[model samples]
Target chain A: MLQSIIPLAVDALANAALIFFVAVGLTLVFSVLRILNVAHGSFYSIGAYVAASVGLWIVGAGLPDWLTFPALLLSAAFVAALFGPIVEKTLVSWTYGKSEAVQVLVTFGLFLILEDLQRIVFGIQSVYQDTPMTMLGISEIGGIVYLNYQLLLIGLAGVVLVALRLFITRSRTGRLLAAVVADREVSEALGIDTQRMFMIAFTLGVFLAAIGGAMATPTTGVAPGLGADTMVLAFAVAAIGGLGQVEGAAIASIIVATAKVLAIYFAPSLDAVAPYLVMLAVLLVKPYGLFGSGSTRKI
Target chain B: MAHRTSIKTLLAATALVTSASVAVAQDKPASLDVGVFTFMSGPAAAYGMPGRQGAEVVIDMINAAGGIDGVPISATFVDEGQGAEGVISEYRRLAEEPETDFMIAALSSGNCLALAPIADQMEMPTVGWNCDSHQLFADAEHPYFFRPNGNTIAEFMAYVIYFLDNNPDVERVAIINPDYSFGHDAAEIVKASLAAFKPEVEIVAELFPKLGSSTYQTEVSRLSAARPDVIFSNLWGGDLENFVRQAAPRGLFRQSQAVFALGESSMNNVDMPEGVIVGVLGDGWWRSPDAAELGAPEFAEAYQTKFEKAPVFPAMKMANAFMVMKAGYEKAIEANGGAWPTDEQLTAAMEGMTIDTLTGSMTFRADNDGIVDQVVGMVGSVEGIEGPVLTNMVRYDGDAVLPPEGEDPMAWIASLTPDFIAAMPKPGSYE
Candidate 1:
């Protein structure tokens, strides 16, 4: 019984670690910007493509193997630095004061454009770079061999969660961003730079999503249509955890990933629809989500 | 007056003779327009692009050899990545064009099933270059569409037979197929074959991951926990590559005997470990003895020179489909006394036809289904070879594994027994 349960727990946590990044980013953007970023998943896939390409080039150039690890982080940083501000300033800012429907429409259109742009830049074939995974080697857990990179992801996710909490509670910029999320007009009246906070919040969200994609490159194949697949799952996670809640997103990632892993292990046929089923169940019970409140503003 | 009457009679007879000759012969066109369908984008393109390249190379070769009866072949490619509705729309759009003579359509089995009846409805002669679903011709017959490679029944069964022959003590089996008709049908066939040959063998786990999935780590863990003696999968294209890449690091292959039904396609792209069971769905291995003897090397060489890579089984299958199509057209033209044949004439000529392909000889059954050998082998490194090559190969007779016509394939497989398995050839017999 212990043996079986150990494998199940490890699988669920490893699966959750990847989803948490994108989900947290989606929730963060929603909390600050007050608009659902439907194109958030595109950032993740772009980061993955960039990381795979850079990693391949590094290895192809006979660079040191340890550099591939830093390349992953640097690639995510590059994608975030490049796409985050430009997208937030241009098409995203245009829909700032519009209706929710307008914001969603604009972002969905952005998703389509970004998806096509990725195909043009990355081509149609899948890109794989496993140097980081191979260099770390393997470990036997619960009597089954698993890549140490997978375990590292679980730890990294925890680190990100703690770091994000500290940043939000202790940092000056984070407090201002939270102040804006609390009441944009009140924060603006208090001499807070609300527009700058929105930009900072959006860029940080892109970093989170991009880092998630970059970390996944070692274990997954980065290919066309990956943005769509990741986007759907991230939406489910956000919905289940309560949109705009970072802690909720983290917990929801585990719930959603566990549902998916359980379905794969037991029913097998329900693997594709398991995450959606969880979302449906959660929403049916808590209309505002697990952590969301209809009357109170919280981030 | 008698001289005038004689001249009029002579002119009338001349008109009658000219009309009879026109009725018996058709004016040959300047070129043959063929609509080729395969995936050109997305993950499946990893498998589909090779097929498209194969079509290009084969068409170039055919056109260079003074063309088919001196008429060049002009091809327009349709990307199957755009879902079935778009594929159907494109097929209709191309079929309505008067100049379109033939179609070598479809890489996905789902697309093939969707387009088969449409081919008959439009009266277009189409060849299924890589679709191998048994369900395509299970219930209804489509005269217009022909598949010159054996279906999932023979393809999956050949793997089971070969693996069982090598590992006679194998008991527990786990399956990880893609969640589609092709994958599910292959799983069913694999299970049926196992039940027939080894009754005590238990299915420890069965996982059907969705097509185009980027990761298989969870499924890999599930497979590992099952601890089966053998793990079987029919995942192809990038899905196969991803699975092999992820699972190899997790020591899954080291623990279990892995059987990849469409494995040869990724052998060039991925570093598949030695001793893993692999096969070309049919006998499309370019390095196989039969394929080597039939000019597959030359075709592969041209393919490498042009595409900058070796030809996988999908490419070889596409080339073979063109060979069969060429044979069909030539036979129809011969039967028509050197005139271009109509669509019905082409289909009729292909019925029960036997022709040589770049891989091996394929015979079209009465129902326009094909009979080709199944080559199963293990991935092994040969001296001076860059990547993995098939070793310890067995070429199963196509007819020996195929179910008889008008019989339910599953029931036929269930009827098989260990005695029947004993009568079949062993692994490494064809080498």
Candidate 2:
């Protein structure tokens, strides 16, 4: 029984690690900007494509394999730096103070354009670069061989969670963003540049999502429709966690991933719908979400 | 006045007879318009693009050689990545054209099943280039739709027989296939074959991952924990490549006797360790001795020159489809006294016809399902080959493995015995 349970737990955590990155980023964006960025998933896929291309180039050029590690981080940073500010300024900011329906439509249109752009640039075939994964090697856990890279992902997820919590609590920019989240009107009246805060928050959100996608390239294939899949899962996690709670996103990621893994193990037929099933049940009880309050604003 | 009216009636009768005679003898067209459906984009394109490229090579070859009855083949390519509804809409749009001659449609079994009836309704002659589902003809008859590369029963059964021959003592088995009709049908066939051939073998785990899934880590771990002696998968295209990449690192290949039914397609794209069981699903192997003798080498050369890569099984299959189509045209023309044949005449010509393909010979059965040999082998390092090549190969006779006409396929598989397999050809026996 213990033997069986160990693999399930490990697999669940590893799965959760990937989901948490996108989920947390999504929650952060909604918390600050108060807009559901439907295009958030595009940044994730772009990051993955960029990371895969750069990593493949590095290896193909006979560069040192360790460089792929930094390449992953740099790839995410590049996607966030390139897409985040520009998108927020040009398209995302235009929907400010508009209806939610308008924001969603605008962002959904952006998502479609980005998806097409990716196809034009990257082509439709899947891209794979696993040098980083191979470099880390494998380990035997619970009598099942596991990728060391997968374990690294679990640790990285934890590190990001801690770092994100501290940044939101301790850093100056974090405080300003939190202030905007708390009361945007009041913060603007108190001399805080809400526009700049929204940009920072949105950029940070993109960075989180991109890093998640970058880290995932070692263990998965990067393909054309990846953004849609990621976006749906992130939405599920965000909904289950409540729209604006970071810690809730972390918990919700675990719940969703565990549901998926468990379904794969015990009921393979239900694997595709397991996460959504859990979300449906959760929402039936907690209408707002696990962490949401009707009137209170918390980040 | 009565005499004048009689003369006018006689002239009108003569004109009607002349027009009827002209319609009876079909006029040769300026060009033969063909609608070729394949996946030109998405992860499936990893498999579908080669089929498209193969069509181009074959079409170019046929047109260069003066085409079928001297009519140049003008192909309109439809991407199946657009989903079934879009594919059907495209098919209808193409079929509505007065000049459309043929359709080589559908790389997916589901799409094939969807379009088969439509082909009949439209009375259009369409050949399934890569549709491998046996169910395509099991329940219904589609006189207009024909598959020349056989079906999934022969394909998956070949793997089971080959694997059991190599590992007679194996007790446990598992399957991880794409979650679709192709995968489910394969699982049923494999399970039925195993139950008949080796009743004691326990099926430890059966997983059907969604198609185009980027990650298979959780599924891999589940497979690892189950620890089956043999792991059989028919995952193809980018999904198969992804599985191989992720599973290879986690030592799944090293742990189990992995049998990738569609492994040959991804050999050049990914690193599959030596000794892993792989096959081309049918006799679509470009390097087989029979294929080498059947002009596959020249076709492969042309493919390499144009695509910068050797033709994979899908390409070979697509090339074979074109050959079958061209042969049908020739047979129809011969039967029509060297004139252009109508659609019904073409269908009649293709019925029960046998023709040599680029890789092997395919014979259309009474039901329009094809009979083609099944080729199975293992990945091995050769002295001159740049990548892993198939070694220890066996060619299973198509007729021997295919169920008899009008019989339930699964029931026929269930009736098989160990003695049946014992009498079949052994590994490396086809060299």
Which candidate leads the pack in lDDT? 2
Off by over 4 Å in 2: B1-23
Q: State the C-alpha lDDT per candidate.
A: 0.92, 0.93
The global Cα lDDT (0 to 1) of model 2 is: 0.93
* A237-281 per-residue lDDT for model 1 (tens digits): 989888888899999999999999999999999999999999999
Scored by TM against the true chain B, the candidates give 0.95, 0.96
Poorly placed runs, candidate 1 (over 4 Å):
B1-24
DockQ of each: 0.80, 0.84
lDDT of 2 by residue, A121-154 (tens): 9988888898999999999888988999999999
Q: Residue B260 deviation, candidate 2, in Å?
A: 1.0
Q: lDDT tens digits, residues B329-353, model 1? A: 8999999988987777889999999
**Tens-digit per-residue lDDT, B113-222, candidate 2:** 99999999999999999998999999999999999976898899999999999999899999999998888999999999999999999999999989988889999999
RMSD (Cα, Å) of model 1: 3.0
